[model samples]
Each structure stands twice: as C-alpha cells, then as structure tokens.
Target: MTKRSDFLAANKGLRVARAGFVLLVLPHAAPDAGDIRRFGITVTKKIGNAVVRNRMKRRFRALVREILPEHGLAGHDHVLIGREGGVERDFALLRKELLVALDRARAGKGDPPRGAKGGRGGGKPHHGRGKGPRPAPESPQT
Candidate 1:
C-alpha cells in the first residue's frame, strides 16, 4: 500500500479525461522506488449535496482500493472525479467503468495496443500522447 504522503507528492502528475470521470495519474520517475500507489477522490459541490458527494467519494475510494493493487502504477498519484449520476450507478458497472478508464489511461501513456483501435477510427489510438479522439462524423441520411 502507498503512503498518504506519497499520494500527496503525486499531486503533479499525468491527467486523463473521460465522460463522467477524470483520472489523475502520476508515474514514479525514480528508479528503485517501491511499487506504491495511492488514490484520492474529489467531488465538487457542483456534483451534488454533502450526502451525494460523500457517497460518490466513498464509492471511488472503494473502487480504487479494490483495483489499485492490480492495475495501479507505482509511486503514482491518482484522483478519480465523481460526476453526476456517479453515485447512483450500479456498483458493478461503476467498477467496470473505473477499471476500463484506468486501463485506458495506462495504455494511453504508452502501454501498447490491445487490438488496434475500435470502430471509433481516429487513426491509431495514441495513449495519452495527444488531445484524445476527434469528433465523430455526422450522418447524412435524410
């Protein structure tokens, strides 16, 4: 498990954006460092009232605790954003989403391709390399 101080130190690290979520990932640059990772949850007032926000934060914390050991990067700082409907969603779905997002963040930072890009087709998916995917083309059926 990563120490709280380490997480604080990771405050300035990589960041990834997704729908209903924003992942802040800070990779460990120093060699010989231990494989330690910590997670922080941020839910702003815009998300909801105290109860709702707290629930969201709790959910995020739980999700991180469950998945970090397997997928979390060493000496990294991670903050998961809690958006509207986040707290209301199903736990399994949320967990799946969180894992996928984290994987995407890791890969985006250069993990390697899983199967070429999906049908989304914005060229090869450059993990964390550029601005993200381009907007989809509009349909012309009239």
Candidate 2:
C-alpha cells in the first residue's frame, strides 16, 4: 500500500483506535487482486522529529509483522496511524493494544467515525499575519 490512493481508500474503511495507534482495515475490493494482505504505517510530523517518527514506524512495522500473520484478516489493507503518546508507550502494551484492536476488527467492530467527535472549527480560519489585511493600515484617519 505504497500509493496515496491506497491510504485514502483505507481511511474510508473500518477504523479502530487504540491508545498507541489507530488501525484501519480496508477489505479487498477487487476479486482480481487476490488475497494479498498489504499493510502500511503512517507517523506524521506532529508526532515528533524525523528520528522519533522513524522510531515509531519501526516499532509499528515490527508489531505488524509479528501479529498480522496469525491474527490479521486476509485480503485486507491494514494501516496503522501513530498517535502522540505512541512513542513513549511500552512495546508490550502497544502489542497488547494491537491485538485487541485486531480482535475488534475481526468482529467487524470499529470505533466511531473520525468526524463524530466534532472539531473546534466554528471560528474563522487564522493566519499568522492576522485578520485578513489589517484594515489597510487606517490611512492616519484623515
């Protein structure tokens, strides 16, 4: 699932969020694609610097490899999205959470839709320069 489209498609699928990460399960849509189970990891810059993001990705990959083979659903694209505290979390705990997430996914259970929680978005968009053109500097008030 190296393509951006794959990730986007997966985002529209089932989502299970754990303390350490969010798991997205996209069932194979095309019969011709076969039962090829693919997976991807996304750790954004918001999580940390490059080093921290990479470390989280590494941990996610290891956990996926260890657990996916036995517990993962075939013909699905599994995407793990890293959260803020994921880096500092214990590996054992993360692994346990992943297992629980997978089990929930297996049972066709997913957390609420991302937008269900709502956002702090009623205010207008803000830019660093502030309030659109600053009233054209007021021209000394004549």
Candidate 3:
C-alpha cells in the first residue's frame, strides 16, 4: 500500500488466520480502471533471519501469483502476514489454507471465528468497578 494508513485500514477488514500466516482482505470502495487486484506480503524479522524472511516473502509472492488472478476479487487489496510456521509449513498445506481462508473471507463465514473473544469492551462485563448498592445496617432488636 502507498500509505501506512492503508495498511492500518485493512486491519479492520476481514481476517483469516492460518497456521502459516494471516490474510487480511479489504474491498475497495471503487474499482479503478483496469480492474487490477493488488496484494502485499509481509515477513517479519521475528519469523527468522534475513534469509528466512526473504524466503518466506518469495513463497508468499509465488502463492499469490498462482492464486489471486482467478480467485481474488477485483478491487480488493489482499495482505499476507507471515507467521512462525510460514517458512516451515508445507507449500501444499499453505495453499489449501490460503484458498479456504479466501473463500471463507468472501463468504463472511470466518469473521470472529468460534471461541474468539467478543467485540467491544474486550468481552468483559462493565459493573462500574465494584459500584453497587450499600448494605443496610442491622436494626436494634426490641
């Protein structure tokens, strides 16, 4: 993406988490001329050394090259974030995960998957931090 805000904005869009990577898909508000799809791949240093990171990035690019043309939605921006398993995982499995993630994302089936924390307030009940009615004092017996 041209700006950091664009990548940040994509984070609010649909997300699919696989063992090897996380896919973020955001649909464009207006399809530009040529209807071309754009994509980005990120391999963090935390994943490995420079060599490993580059390898992961290359693998991701190849995967996108093979998959996105026919399967990806035009006017949608796709970002692939590499994870710890990205370099070690089998290529075939990675492909399967990507395809499944894409289908689920488009179908809107994987938004906040099962057992995930609920949205807003971080799934915690708000009780005003122990604020409640005071207990009444004991009355004197007759």
Per-prediction TM-score, please? Answer: 0.62, 0.80, 0.76
lDDT (Cα, tens digit) per residue for candidate 3, span 1-142: 6667767777777888999999988887564625677788877789989999999999999999999998886778888989998899999999999999889888976556335675463565676788588899999999
How well does candidate 1 score on lDDT at residue 22?
70
**CA RMSD per model (angstroms):** 12.5, 5.9, 3.8
Estimate every model's Cα lDDT from 0 to 1: 0.71, 0.91, 0.83
lDDT of 2 by residue, 30-93 (tens): 8865657789999999999999999999999999999998888888999999999999999999
Candidate 1, superposed: residue stretches over 4 Å from native? 1-12, 28-32, 109-142
- Residue pairs in steric clash, candidate 3? none
Better of 2 and 3 by lDDT: 2
Top-down lDDT ranking: 2, 3, 1
Best by lDDT: 2
In model 3, where do residues sit more than 4 Å from their true spots? 31-34, 113-120, 123-142
lDDT at residue 140 of model 3 (Cα atoms): 100
